[model samples]
Target: MLILWICFLRGARPILFIDGCHLSSPYKGTLLAASTCDANNDLFPIAYAIVSAENNENWIWFLSNLKELTGSISVTLISDRHPSIIAAVEQVYDRDRHAYCYRHVKENFCVETKKLQRGIRGEVKEDAKKLLDAVCYTHFGTEFTKAVEQLRAFSPELANWLETKGDINKWAKSQFPHRRWDLITTNVAESFNSWIRKERTHSICALITEHRDKLANLLYIAKLEMTKWNNEVGPKIDKILMEHVARSEFLKAVRYGDHNVMVRGSNVDVCVNLLRKECTYLEWQMTGIPCPHACAAIKLLHSNIYTYVEECYLKSSQEKIYASSMIPIETHDMPDVNNLTLTDWENNIFLMPPTTTRSLGRLCKKRRESQFQDVHVYKCSRCDQSGHNRSKCRNPNPEKI
Candidate 1:
C-alpha cells in the first residue's frame, strides 16, 4: 500500500495511504502491522513496530519505536482502537501533536460497547451517541467528558477503568480542535483494503511482489501526467519564491535594540529591546509567538538565529504565508474523499513484510533474561495460590482460616 501511495502521489497529487492488517507468519503468530508512503513515490515499509493485539507488553514496546519514528516531525497517526495502539500513542504523543482517526475512535467505541457494555449499554446509549457526534477535536473533550460522567452513573467500574489508564484531562485537551471529521475515522485504509481484495488472492509472496510492481507502474504514470502541470506551476512557484526572499531579507534588516533583529539566544547587553513591550503582551496572553523584541533578542544573542524564528515566534506558520490570493492555496483545503479519485486500481500495490530480529515484546524479555533474573513467580498471601501475588489475593486471611 505504501508503494502504491507513493506512486499515486508522484503524479503531482501527493497522497499517503495508511492501513493495518492481520497476517500470519511462518514462525510467529498473527501480527498487526502498519505501513506509509510519501509524495516522492518513496515507499517506507513497516515504518513502525509490529505488535500483537493480545499482549500488554506490546503497547510499551510499540511506544519505544513510535518515539523513534515521530522524532520532531509533525506527524499524525490513524489506527483502529487496539488498546496497544491507543496506549502507545498516548505514551509517545501526549502533546497532541498528532491527529487521530475519528473513524477508528467511533468504531472502537461502538465495538467495545456492543461486546462489553452488556450491563450498562442501555443506560449509556445516549452518552455514546453524543461522543460519536463529537468526533472533531473542538468538541471531543466536552462530549467525551459528559458521556463518561453519564457512564460513571451507570458503571463506575468502566469509568474508573478509563481514568486509571491515563490522565483523562490531559488526553482531552490534546485531542480538541480536530482538523476534520473524516480524519477521525479508519476509511483511508479501507480504500486500500478493497483494492487489495480485488487485486490479489494468491500466495503471500505473489501478493507482496505483484502489488509492489503495480504501484511502481502507477507512480510512473502519475509522474507522466504531472509533468505538464509541474511545468506550469514551476515558473509561478519561482516567482513566489523570489518575492518571499525579498520579504525575508527585509525582515532580517529590520533592527531591534543595538543588534540586528534575530530569532535566537543573546545576552541582554548585546541586544536592544526593540519590541520588549510586544513580547510582554504575548507572554501575558499565553500566546507562543515571539514579540518583536524577542525577534530582536534573537539577532543579538546567536550567530545563527533565523533557524528558530518559525518555531519560537510564529504560533501558527499558517499565518506567515500572507496574501489574500495565497490564503486559499495555502490552506489546500481539499474537498471530501468521495470527491477524490482512488484513481488507478490496477496500479495499487502492497509492501514486503518487514524483517525483525525479534518480536516487539522480546526487548523486555531479553532485557530480563540478560539481567539473569529469576522467573517472576507469584504467591498469594491469603490463598497461598501460585498464580497470584499478595496484592492480588482475593481470599480471606490465611491465618484466620
Candidate 2:
C-alpha cells in the first residue's frame, strides 16, 4: 500500500489529519498517512509510510519520523480515539498538540449510549445527543459547563464517558490551544485512502509508482485551475466571501469605534472587531474567514471585505502551494522488465485458495462499513428500484414486492 503527505513547510496549516487504512489482498499491512489542506482547501499529501500493522511500536516509529520532518515546528495532529495513535502522539508530540476527531467522538458516544441506555425512550435519547453536541461544539467555558451538566442530568454514564475517555480541550474548537484551521477530523486522510483504493491490491512497488503519478497529475490539474481564478482569493474562498456578504445584508451593524463594532442578528448580537478580524461567534477564528456578523461589521466601515480574509486563502498563497514542479515519468516504450524479459512475476506467483470448509450462506461481496458512514444504495436496472443491481437482484420486476 501507498501512504502520502503534503509538505506543510510553507503555505499549509500546522495541523495534520492522520489515520491508517488497511491494505487489501496480496498485501498484508497498513498504510499510515498524514495529510493537510492547501490554500485552496484541497487535500495535499506530505509523506506516507507503510507498516506491518497498526500497533504502538509501528505508530511511534511513523510519528517519530513525522517529528523529525517537522523539526522544532510545534504541530497539531488530529485523528480518531485509537489507543495506539493516542499513545504514539503523546510520545512523539506534545499532549496538548494531539486532538481527537469530533465525528468519531460523537459517533462513538451515540453508539455507546444506545447500548447503555437500552429500552430508554427515543425522545430522551435524542435530547441527550443534542446536549452532547452542544458540549462538544460550544465555544465558551460557561456554555460548555452548562451543556455538560445538562447532559449529565439526562445520561450521567455517557457524560462521564466523554469527559473521562477524552479531553474537552483537545476536541472542542473553542478550547484548542492552537489554530486547527477548522480541520477537526481525519476525513482528509480517509479520502486519501479511498483515492488509492484501486492501488491497494497491487504490489508495493507498483502501488508506490502509481501514487507518484497520481500525485503529479493531481498537482498539475490544480496548477492549471489556479490560473483561472479571477479574484483576490481562490474560487472557493471567494465563493465563501460572497456567501458571507449575502448573509451580512440581513443583519445590522453598530459601530463601537474604527474597527470595533456590534453586529446584531435575529438570534444573537455579536461583537466584531474588523481590525483583528475577530467575532464573538468564533467562526472567524476557526476558518480564517470573516463570519457573516464580521462581514456585516466590515460592510459598515465600507472596507474591502476581501482584505478581511486570511492570507492563506489569498490567490498568491494558493499559487505558492503549487509553485513546486513535479518531473514527468516516461513510462511508455520502456524496457520490458516483467514476464517477457525473464520468467514471470504475476503469472509465476500463484497461491492456493482458502482450505476452510464451505459455509451454507453466500459469501459476502462487500467490505463492512463503519456505523458512522452513510451506506451507498445501488439501483437495479431490472427492477428499476434502489438497493440492488441488475445481476444478483432479488426482485426482477418493479411491482413484484
| Top lDDT prediction, candidate number | 2
Model 1 segments more than 4 A misplaced:
1-19, 24-72, 83-100, 111-127, 135-182, 198-201, 220-401
Q: Which ten residues in a row have the lowest lDDT in candidate 2?
A: 350-359
- Model 1: per-residue Cα lDDT over 128-168, one tens digit each: 64543532332334556776676566556545654664234
Q: What TM-score number comes out for model 2?
A: 0.83
On a 0 to 100 scale, what is the lDDT of residue 135 in model 2? 83
Q: Which candidate is the best by TM-score?
A: 2
Per-model TM-score, in order, reads 0.37, 0.83
RMSD (CA, angstroms), candidate 2:
6.1
lDDT of each residue in 314-372, candidate 2, tens digit only: 87777777777677667686545552533444464433221223348996658877776
Overall lDDT per candidate, in order of appearance: 0.41, 0.80
